[model samples]
Every structure is written in structure tokens, then in C-alpha cells.
Target: MDTRHFTFALRHHMVADTLLLEFHGELDAWADLELAPRVAALLRRRRRAVLVDLRSVTFLDAGGLRLLLRISERSPRRKGRVRLVLDSPQILRVLRITGVDGVFTVLGELPVPFAADDTPDDTDVPA
Candidate 1:
């Protein structure tokens, strides 16, 4: 399980070629700032699949939602894609209320055999 702890609120590990992020605390403005640099770097990498697990999150706010939406913006048609793994009622309710649940490819569990390609191409990833 190769992983890097981004902060108290976010921790990420790699499975196969997919990067999985697990949230432990509030992913508000603070976590958004802390995670931006890393996410920017990943976006620069072409075809890097990202998976976010939010089942552990107790709270969901706009700032956090923005971050998730940003990550999900990666083109799903290519190998560079983002999927959300969440089952929290609180989080689901927030997504539903915000009408964002339909915006993402939500999954109940992590996928097996992830898709990862290290070759990255610049894509105007905002930092």
C-alpha cells in the first residue's frame, strides 16, 4: 500500500495505478489549500486515474465539494479520470441537495485492478 499522507484531513494511497484519497476530517478551505498542489501535479500527469473515498467524512461543505468537482473534471473519456467512492448518508444528502451526485461517477466500493499511466501531458492544471 504505497501512500502519502497529505494532512490530518486527507490521506492518499495507490492501488495498481489508481490513486485513492481517503478523508478523515473536514475537507473545508484548509484541506482544499493543502490538497491543491498535489492535485495540480497529478493533473499535469496524463492518464492518471484518481479515486476519492469519502465514506469516513462526517461533514461536507462547499469548499470540499469544489475540490471534488475539480478532480472529477478530468476527462472521463481518457485514462485520466476521477471516480468517487462514498456511501455516507450525510455526504450523499449533501451531493443530492447540491445536485452534484449526478455530476460524478459515484461508486459504492473501490474498483479492482486500477488504471495508471505515468506519462503526463500538460493540460493547464490550475495551481
Candidate 2:
């Protein structure tokens, strides 16, 4: 319900069929609820792949992490893949400590280079 201090920008690379969702500002408890539905709707669009560019995100709590996990789960069932572009040590530590790091493929940084025929490797993604 509250949309203050939060913004989301989406940019797609048609060549690689990757949807880069850049999240800026805060992703706290309140924003988590509102943000998830939007993300879910976008995922349902059959974008082929989703790359969440969280590098610009200033903060992400447990709720935000949950949202990512949920979306990751849905992407595969819908015949797509999800990758999280995150470089923050805080987020990395949290994901690692909680054992969710293996749940999602965490890219080292943003602007991930992809070839036109890039395809998800079965070994690297979740079932």
C-alpha cells in the first residue's frame, strides 16, 4: 500500500532474452508485500529469463529474500530461469549463512554479459 522511497526499473535485452529488473531504494518489510505481486506478474509474462539486478539496492531484508526465492521457484516451473545480480557483502553473507545461496544463482556483479544464444545449464539451476 505504501509506495514511498521505493522504485523499480525494468530493462530487457532482447538479444539474450533476459529481463533485467533493477531495484533501487529500500526493500523493507512493507515494500516486500507490494513488490512480490508485481514481480510475479512480470514472471508470468514468459520473458524466458529474469536477472534481478540488485546491485543498486541499498537494503534488502528477510522478506525481500523470500520474495526472490518464491520467484526463483516459479521461474523454473514456468520454463524459465532466474538469476540474482548482487555484489553487496551483507546480502551475500545473509544468503550464505542461511543456506539459500545455493537456491538461486548469485551473479558477482551487474551488467552481466550474455551471448545471443545463451541458455540455462541444467546443472546450475534448480529443479
Candidate 3:
């Protein structure tokens, strides 16, 4: 049997009091592990809000969905808000099917200020 491990990329941005995290590639078990600590640290800062951009995500599984929910729950404790941005129909279906679509604040695009970038192809990703 062949085993395959998937990886994802995360780009962090701050728009005033809002912390934006843009995710690309597959968000699975491995991604959940990699993202937990980074996200936890951000949550601890108690930002006014956090926006997770899933527009570029190619795949999302149950673990990924759970991670989003977990973030949402944790943010409010720190007096912060969490929102998700999704553009793919297939990804939307996953949320809808899981009955979590209504549970989150979902958007189509990155809200202003955060959308103004000098380089269209540039990704301000972390190492």
C-alpha cells in the first residue's frame, strides 16, 4: 500500500484589528496539526477579529471543518470574532452537507484593505 501525506500553506495578514489567514492546498489531519499552534498563538492575542480565507483551498475534510469550528469557539472567549471566506462550490457543498454553513460567518472575497495588494501573485506567507 502507498501512503500519501498532504500539506497546506497558510498566509497570515493583519488588517487593522483583524487577523486574516489565507489557506491554500489541502487542509487535512497534517494541516490541522501544523496549524493548531500558530492559530492558538494568534487567538491568545485577542485580536478584534479573525478571517480565514478558504478561497484557494483545494480540499477540506472533517478535520479541517472541525478546526474552523474550534477556532470560532476559541475566538469568542478571547473577545474576538471568526469568519470564513469560501469561493469554491465544491467546498461550499462540504460545509452545507456538514450543516456548518449557517454556523459560521461566510464571505465570498477578502474584505477591503486586506484586498489591496501591490502584487497580485505575491503571497505573504510565513516560514
Candidate 4:
């Protein structure tokens, strides 16, 4: 196997009260260094909600999975919700195999904005 370091990129924005974070490139150990602090900063701001867009993430490992879990755990205490948007089959499989899929509100795409009382249309990952 090629022992090359992986890199990751992040693009984020606010839609209504939700903070949408888009991840690109491999999400591995190396990428954690770049991602953790940024995410921490965002969390510190106490955003009402967060949506992690993983459509462009090409690779994920245990570290990456842990990071996602950490985000999910923290979001609720901050009075926010965290949803994940995943499009890659490989990434999806990893989550399923690890049984982490059930721990998150995974979606195929970003849900349409809805009032607190209204149910938004969302694609849920299969169990």
C-alpha cells in the first residue's frame, strides 16, 4: 500500500439557523489535524444546528468516524442537531459495518428548510 498522507478540505455556510459543513478529500488521521480545530471553533459558536455534507469525502477511517461521533454527541448539548449527508457507497458501507449508521441522522441530501413543527423531506440511510 502506498503510504501517502491524506488531505481534506472543508467548505461551510449557514442556511437559516443551520451550519452546513461540506467535506472534500480523504477523511483520515492526517485530515483530523486540519478538521478538528475548525469544527471545535464552530461548535464554540453554539450554532443552532449542523449538517455535515460528506458527498465529496473519498475515504474515511476509524479516526474520521470518531470525529463524526464526537460532533454528533456535542451538537445536542449545544441545543443543536447534527445530520450527515453521505453519497459514497464505500463510506456508507463503513458506517454500516461499524454499526455507526444507527447513531446518526444520516441523509442522502440536505433537507428542505422546514418549520419546527413541519417535517422536512429527508432521505434516511437504510438500517
Candidate 5:
């Protein structure tokens, strides 16, 4: 058996009280197995919105997408939301092709301080 480990560095940007988490590493199988849970835990903060920056990510696979979907689905229950800051065409295509592009809100880049007028609907997300 081959043991593979992924090294990840996480940074956060505050936008309108929301948190945008930037990932630095390959969000692949290894990441899903070892890093996803940690990332999710880190994101479980007191906020209404969060964004995962996948721009610096070198590789992404099904597991990676699944992790995002899981986070997006779970975030709302906590009165919060999760979005993606993906700039790569390949990454965008993957999300769109998977038909999950609608599942997560994507921004042009990582928006800081969720615009003054940019208020999200209070569906499950808290005000």
C-alpha cells in the first residue's frame, strides 16, 4: 500500500463578515481523505457565508467536488453558506459539467466584505 499525504495551507479573507477560505494545495483524493474534514472544521466558525478559493489548487477530482458539495449543503443548516472562488477554466468546467455549478455561488474572485448592497437572502442563512 502506498501512503500519500497532502500538505495544505489555509488562509481566510473576511468579506462583509463572511469568511473566504483560500486553499493552497492539490484538492485531490489525498486531500478529500485527509484535509476535507479539517477544512470543514476550520470553516465552522460564526459567520453566515464562506467561500473556498480553489484558484491556487493544482489538481481537483471527483472527491474534491464532492467535498465542496457537502460543505455547501451543510453550511445552510448552520445559518451559513459556502461559495467557490475558482478562476481556472478547467475547474469551472468541472463544476458546471457536474451540474453543481448552481449548488454553490461562485464569484469573479474572492469578494471581500460582501458588498454593501450585496446582501444574501435569509433562506437558511442568518442575517
Candidate 6:
């Protein structure tokens, strides 16, 4: 496996009621360690929209896909909403071939201040 870009980054941005988790670099199995736990924690604590920006991700593997799957399956029930920002054709193709794309609300770009399903008192929750 290529480790050239194995390192990944997860950034938190809160705008209005939406929380954006912007990602960069490879999102493979190892990436789950960095992203999954954080997302899970966010779901448990925050009641707001979540925008996962995967546009800068250079690579993805099953490990990374699993994290996305978990978020797609669990966030709606546990949080306000979940959306994925994808721009990589390679990553999109992988998701498509694996049928993982069907489960997510994919977008080319993030919508500023994503509207939440329910309004809660604004809080500074870290992701």
C-alpha cells in the first residue's frame, strides 16, 4: 500500500449550527483511528449538521470506507444530519463500485451554515 500520503488531517469548523470536518490525505483503515473516534464522539455530543469534507483526500481504503459507513449509518439517528463533500474521481469511483455512495448525501461543495434538523443551544463542541 502506498504510504506516501498516508497521513490525514481532520479539521473542525463551526459555522452557525453546522460543524464541518474537513479531511486531507489518505483515508484508509488507519485513518479510522484519527477520524472515526472523533466523529463518533461528535455524534454523541453535538446535535447539529455535519459536513465531512473529503475533497482533499488523496487515497482511501476499506478502513477509511468503514468510518464513512459508520457515520452514514449512525449519525442520522444520533445527530442532526450528515453530508459528505467529495471531489476525487478515484475515491468517488471506489465508493460507487462498492455501493457505499448510495448511503450518503454526497455533495461537490459544502453549503455554508448547514441547517440543522432541530435547533439546540449553541455550544462549542470539538471534533
Considering every candidate listed, which one attains the maximal TM-score? Answer: 3
Give candidate 2 regions above 4 Å deviation.
1-15, 77-81, 111-127
C-alpha RMSD of candidate 2: 8.2
Report the candidate with higher TM-score, 2 versus 5.
Answer: 2
TM-score order of candidates, best first? 3, 4, 6, 2, 5, 1
For candidate 6, lDDT tens digit of each residue in 1-127? 5545448766665666566667777887777875677777776655456777788789988988998888766564444347789888999999899998887778986564543322333322223
TM-score of every candidate: 0.70, 0.71, 0.82, 0.77, 0.71, 0.75
lDDT of 3 at 109: 85
Which candidate, 1 or 6, would have the higher TM-score against the true structure? 6
TM-score, model 6 to reference: 0.75
lDDT assessment of candidate 6? 0.71
Top model number, lDDT: 3
- Backbone clashes in model 2, listed as residue pairs: none
Superposing all C-alpha atoms, what RMSD in Å does each candidate have to the true structure?
7.3, 8.2, 4.5, 8.8, 8.5, 6.5
Clashing pairs in 3: none
Candidate 3: stretches off by over 4 Å: 1-6, 77-81, 117-127
By TM-score, the better pick of 2 and 4 is 4
Candidate 5 overall lDDT versus native: 0.64
TM-score of 3: 0.82
* Candidate 3 overall lDDT versus native: 0.75
Worst lDDT run of 10 residues, candidate 4, spans 118-127
Q: Candidate 3 at residue 91, lDDT?
A: 92
The sequence of per-residue lDDT tens digits that candidate 5 reaches over residues 1-127 is 3333335445555666566566666666666666666656655665676677788777778977777776776563454346788788988888888897887777667564543433333211101
Q: Per-residue lDDT for 1-127 in model 2, tens only?
A: 3433335333333335665566665565655676676667666777777777677667777877787787787673443357788889987887888888887778886553643333433111001
CA lDDT, candidate 6, residue 44: 67
